[model samples]
Target chain A: MSGQTSAAVAAAAKSVHQDEEELHGLLVPDATDLPLFPLSAVESNFVAYFAPDFTKPSHDHYIYRHPNGLCVVGLAPGHAALRDEGGVKGVDFNVGKSDRSAIKVTGKRKKNAQHFEANTMLCKVSTSVDTYVIRCCVKGSLLEVNEKLVKQPGLLNTAADREGFIAIIMPKPADWLKVKSKFLSREEYSNLRVESL
Target chain B: MVAGSEAEEDLRAFREAVSLVPWHVAKDLISREVCLHCIIRLFGIREPAKGFTSLSPSMFSDIVAELPSTGEGLNGIELGENKDKNDDETNEERHPAPSICSVCFGILQICKVNDAEIPFEKNGVNFLANVIADAVKEEGHEFDSFCVEVSTPPAIPENDLSLLSYINSKYGSESWLQKKPLGNIISLKEALKALVTGPLETKLGVNCSQGTFRIWLTYKEASPLTSCDDKTPVAKRQKTDCNNKNTLVACTTYGLVAENEATEPCVDSGKITMTIPTDGFGNGIAYHESSCLSKSREPCSLSIECYRDAVYFGGRYLKYSRNVSQTCWMIDEERMGVTSVEEIISGCILPFCRGDKSKFHAAGREDIDVRMLGSGRPFLVEIQNARHVPSIMDIKGIEEKINESKSKLVRVKHLKLLGSEAWSLMREGEAEKQKQYAAVVWISRPLEDRDLCTLSSFKDLSIMQKTPIRVLHRRSPLEREKIIHWMKIERISGSSQYFVLHLCTQAGTYIKEFVHGDLGRTNPSIGSILGCRAEILQLDVTDVKMDLF
Candidate 1:
């Protein structure tokens, strides 16, 4: 009789543990498992605009501006760099004389943040075919460059809009207004790239 | 301020009590230039001695002369009217012979009202009451009861200790000392209050109760020598102005040697062994030398201040204009909204209370664009130093004034006067209460029947949210878990993409972020469940589930 009671206790404890697991899944789903289609989490918070063939043909990039003036710079899906075979094999933030990621930007003041022009090189991406240099595309203070792409270059190939975003830049209100009319809005970009996408 | 018959009866009681004191101690203190009221208080006489407050030094001499002297030579000292022949020579040369008291420092001798010197003969309590009543009437306060607050100089407590100790050491074994030990002596503060409270009540036409309305009488020793002496250390002068009651009582009781070193210019080290100088006893004669500097002392400078406690007006307030903020919000010297709910409400109530400044607090606040629509939100306005506390009808008039203003931005309901306790109650409800909001939402995909079923199925659904990017510049970055208690969808008559999404959520839940999901920082959001892009257009608070009025 004692052996039977011990078995019943073990079974009940297992059920309780399973219940906690099910509750955890319902409450805190992992960020990648959020079930959003087509767009990443970062894409949802910003208004996407595109800059196509700037200074060179087929050189395309996307600028995602949040309501606050911070803009995320990255390659659009139809960019010439993403068209390379085997996708991106390596990412580097050391294209310029100083490594962009090594510069420490601290505090609400964004101390040590470097000012960049619209054509400043943010980083370099190497595919199996050839390497391509990505530009900032907007004039602003460069707040941060995503360091995750340097360690996991495959993230750019898989989720470019999410974890593979390039530097975040803060443009002054006057600067944002000057460059704001130059880029295509999301609808305008979609219409232009309907055949290519 | 007291009636004539009552004053006479009080004088009779005071004289009988004075006659009972042993004659030698009275003559000794009288010759020391201690005033009459201080002598009565030093004998530990706790009677209602309202009549003796006006007695000058000579009248006090007459009272002591009637008592038979225990010693023969003391009679000469008692009969003379304050002849300070043996006092300090420098003190005598500085002023006239009729100097302030050695112990009380003219606090019990004269009252200065409205920059005019009124001696005790004019009744200090009566003049004090007149000054206080004039100020109260000038401000036009409406109070039914009041409490008196008294603050005296630190030197006065030190002097009381010195004189009481001198009497105790000189006559420790006398029959009068045995009848009422020196320990039973009333403090100068208590005696002054006893003499003043009755007259003040009569003058103000109010009863004396522990009420919010207060009359403060602050007394400072106005010795010109102390202020002008450039050689005095700044610390010592500051110690004199400290006037902290508990520290004074501690120094009086424990006989701190440090006190003598810091405070006394004429430091006598031998008196350190005295037993809680509060007991009116000292072991050595060194303590008596300090109180002997009685000549040329001026009366304390008296200042009166009247303050009514912070009056709280509490009610539920509704905001109709979306351009009005919950409070005055300023960013980099620029105003965000046209005005605030605080300005509209406090502007009306401040004139009624006549306060120095007013503070506005609410159970919770909405964004500048969100309107408070239903029963509104609980709020309180705390008015500090109010001269007038409004009646119920006055509060109603103030509420109507806010609602009927030309702006039509805010309205109030169930307006009433609340104690300070209501502030804490509203803050307590602010953290734990639930809030319901109605949002005009648009989705990228068409609204299906299953979408409504999917959104309404969440009950007690918990989600983790990082602070939204809009507020991240100021707030600490943290993930907070919030509960969405329930949600429902109401279809618009002619629109599939736009509908009203009603949701009940825990307090502090960001409703706009919960719908759009703040870039997936909030999990299981409305946009996530519908598997499409969702946006909140306009929001209104429908209800706040707190029991407060």
Candidate 2:
């Protein structure tokens, strides 16, 4: 009986050790150079398009269009709006009588959303020196605006390309094809704006 | 009645069993308006008395009269008056209301039929079986065996417990009981099934077995007697709020009054406190007496339903017409295609099985303009509540019928009846399956020898594809990487710009978008690789690789 008990004890200890080893294997992270916030991951999926000097001069904007035809709109690095002394101090979605952020675009049908032209006013951004009205760079239906910018306006100056994206737009296939030629590719945009940088 | 001698012997045994119940307990239960079936079932005599399950209330009273009453006070004046009224009724069918068993409502009594009772002389197992068999026949199902299921109201079990408590309190210290009043008692549900199953089997010419086919007999108190019912609007309720009130009363009585001997709430709860009735039994009896008096003589309503398990037919189908869709597609109440592959196949098979409805599923679907040629796609048709499960020969007939359809849009192959496991097996291969397609391509520039070599050289080319523009409104926007497993271009004899581009790819890769590039939504497409504009005119699914039929 003592011998049997000792064997049982050894088996129990072996199982516990195996379980711990399996758990440790799961807990150990894989060796990778990928960062927690990997910018390369975003760049690999969405192709960056740029529209410089839209309605007025130096009003540059970038349309990062995903392969699925969803465009993430934001200010390009060469935009005159970001050249203010104190940077962007505040952002307001109430451009007109109605607040653009209050509309809830729900379901795949995207009900209660409005269609906008390429030059439609999206929102207003205030700086220490001047206030600028941002325009929708792509002709499409407006899906959503980044509400996080209201509380943290400094994000637009620090990380405008990432978390500080202005709006997401869904373009119809015909509309996308029609407005596609006006925007320059990433390589073309960088080459054209080389002197501004 | 059909088998005279056997019915007589069964009736004789039933009377002998009734005589065995102690006279005092019988008199007390009869006074409380318990049905004879409820009394026998409460004592757990269902197993031996299974043959004659349907005894009339008058016949039961006649047997109770011969039980040799030992005292003058045991006449049971209420039961005597009910029996006299039962004999005087000209229709011979007693209205179940006044004497309906307080415990079972009227389920065991089987007395209520279309708001009128079955005549007392003919109220037996045979009569009940006729009622159930007629309903089964009306449904037009073909079955060899079935299991009968019985469901009763909550009050039935409550009444059983109440009567048992009365028995324990009144006969706790009697000389006949050497131990507590716990014995081999069958439940109300089991007793009803036993009574009905034997007769049902004889009448329907089928034996009771543990089969997929089921005959469900649901008994409910048509209208419960509750004082609070007047305040609430009547909207056709199945379980009344009065049953919930009774449960609360039973709960408070169990927790406070029967402290040491508290049982669980249902019939199983009674088993825990079988040793003691306690002081709660008195209040329980008083509550039952007042409610039983207030309850109308209306018997519980019975509804019968028949169901057979879902029958599956698995097969492969070929679509010959480009106008035919994989399934029915409607846009704003207008048809998208002439017809669908689902309609032609399901429409042919549904009437044969006589099922309630049919559902069509496939491994994957192609565009309505694309024809499915070569081996065909695997699919399954599930017929819910199928009255007739087709045999192997019947399936062959159906296959021949669908293949010979006049429209000639769809044809089926390898049509076979399959078990339910076929459903899971087809679904398992849907995600990872490979598909091959052949498209007629037209390029802006002439096709050269190097172009053919470049296309065939890549063994596995990975490309980023987004949700196609045609389906973007319905599908979530996401960029997915799919593999073009292999490709081969077949050159036309006289054409310089046109060639048949045949390629095998991952299951969900959009073929048309890969050729024209959907305005560059798909990267490194044929248009980009060839350094020219490309367009696909016609496409056909050459093969789908799944091991299922």
Candidate 3:
């Protein structure tokens, strides 16, 4: 926090939606060497964006996913009040200040339930700025969540998929042939923006 | 090139799924109709019955009224609720939906988008097609096929772009959440083609492509390109704040104005508008369906007048009058003759062809005093905006009639229609043919029989001819090499040191210059090569050996 600026100073995210940033030296990773999720994953209303380099005046940003099964969620500057450490009785998500992960793993219920369905509710992530409800985008088993983010939750805003991971899950319903049609390819994802012929 | 992209593999895998898509599986993926035969889906309000769009109007409306209260639009609908009373209630009272064909459904019962949908309009394709069809009929030309060209100002849609910028700043484009809702408006060119091509083809009863005729449609719709805040102060479309969504359209260099400006000179305040056709689009620009469909035969804001493409006729003409030139003679901006070969021929063909303008072309031309003989010279006349060429008209009769005319100045042979491509071939052969000429020579020295014998051995003799003094005022003085293929000399009575010479030479060899040497501009001429000063008193082209017809 002395030589480099991080989101620990919540003001960095206050006007993030305006494209006006007063950022400092930061890492800008490219799309290469990134984890790839199969296109068979469920479709959802949510999308993700990451700003890697704050130094260059302009640069093109592309989409990437954590190969180890972790996703980062940006937060509002005032997320300290919403910190849920432990789950309430009969509640699926942790409701208090107890250490927890953003995604979860459980036994498969059935095979047909795995097709392009939604709201699988995985885990929860509490960053320095905000709290987010993470869900399992595909039918998968949780490997583990990042232990490093427990004591230093600011890692959720800074390192994200690298040192700070939400969870690692192997996709479920072993027959990949049937579920592979759910995910979008990179070109299809890029084509979400209109292009000239 | 960089390393092979993994994104390509992703596209291939997705294409595998695309191949398995069920053609016409549902009336449409768009959920519009609902009824008794309609099976409740895993996550939905009631969808259409299998093989049917809807059971009845009452059943469809009944389900729509109950959907919002159940919070189904924001999330998924609950299934299995109707399991108990299914058979008796649905079968006894409600009527099943009718089975419809894909083609019939598309034409007669295609459901339009609901009121909640924005930026997506219905019948836009039909509106444009009908307008183009009627406008094309108004032109009253018999054409097989045509293409449509739409011109737009490439204006920025500030509101939609602003919405895009708002998404980019928060999500940062590094993840999935921001990728889906980036831009709202499609590229203008793509949208225009999608709207016009299909509708136009259906209306004209022919394919939009591979037709004998070409139709050009221009729409000057978009606002002028917005200039960046640079001081080239030359107004150029500079993409700045490109990552921000508010300037999304500006940041894209693919706008039509930017494309047209790439090769052409930008004059409209350092920007280019769309290409304005010869018949200009009326003053205001057109984009919307209502404004474009009923406006007029011409598209621009100002009313446009339309005209047909030109028709061409190729024939060989015999110019009998030595005083008549190929075209009208103009001296100091004043015409000297009432008519030329071009005018006399145009006067005869134009009345039958219904054309407005005429242009004359020939393989090679002779001097005004030289009359064309033999099979005549290959010529073509391009008749602009020709409305008709009657099938009953006799080409041979026209030729005879022209030959019998009182003037008899220019008579045509092999009068036939020719495509426009032959015009270039006729022009190209002008330099390749061999020409034979009959001339009266005047020699300064006494003519001897031995000197005339020396000229016969000069076969295939090549000479360097510069621009002659007579034409130098109008022609550039560049040197050219021409070959005298062969020359024939005939002896005539030398009463006044005059002799008749029949010479055969190359096309464009400048025969007059070769005999007199043109002040030494032409080397090895009859005067320079024979050591006898020579000049030509009269010259006539006897035979032009190229067959262009």
**lDDT by residue (tens digit), candidate 1, A142-166:** 8778776889888688757644677
Clash numbers, per candidate: 1, 1, 29
Worst 10 residues of 2 chain B by lDDT: B227-236
lDDT of 2 at A137: 87
Residue range with the least summed lDDT across 10 consecutive positions in model 1 chain B: B225-234
Best by TM-score: 1
Give the alpha carbon lDDT tens digit for every residue of A60-160 in model 3.
12212333222222221122212323311111234233223442322233222222222344345543444455444444433334444456555544433
- Quick one: ranking by lDDT, best first? 2, 1, 3
What is the TM-score of chain A, computed separately for every candidate? 0.78, 0.81, 0.36
- Across residues B1-549, which tens digit of lDDT does each residue of candidate 1 receive? 345555445545656666655566677677677776887787777757344544333434444545674553232333322344123343334433445677777776654655687743345666776777887788777789988766776666666665655555555555555455564567787787777787678788898889988777777767632332222221232354354345335344333222222222321223333332433342323235343464666677776677788889999998877799999999779998999999999988898778989999999899998988676899999998888888788888898888898877888988999999998899888899999888877787878999889889889999888666566544444568999999998776566677778889999999988887764556678887898777776688878899999
Regions more than 4 Å wrong, model 3: A1-197, B1-140, B156-207, B221-311, B336-338, B346-356, B389-404, B444-452, B491-499, B528-533
Docking class of 2: incorrect
- Give the lowest summed-lDDT range of ten residues in model 3 chain A: A22-31
Residue runs of model 2 more than 4 Å from their true location after superposition = A1-168, A171-197, B2-23, B48-50, B53-57, B68-98, B161-185, B226-287, B292-295
TM-score of each: 0.72, 0.67, 0.44
Query: Candidate 1's error at B281, in angstroms?
Result: 16
TM-score of chain A of 3: 0.36
Best by lDDT: 2
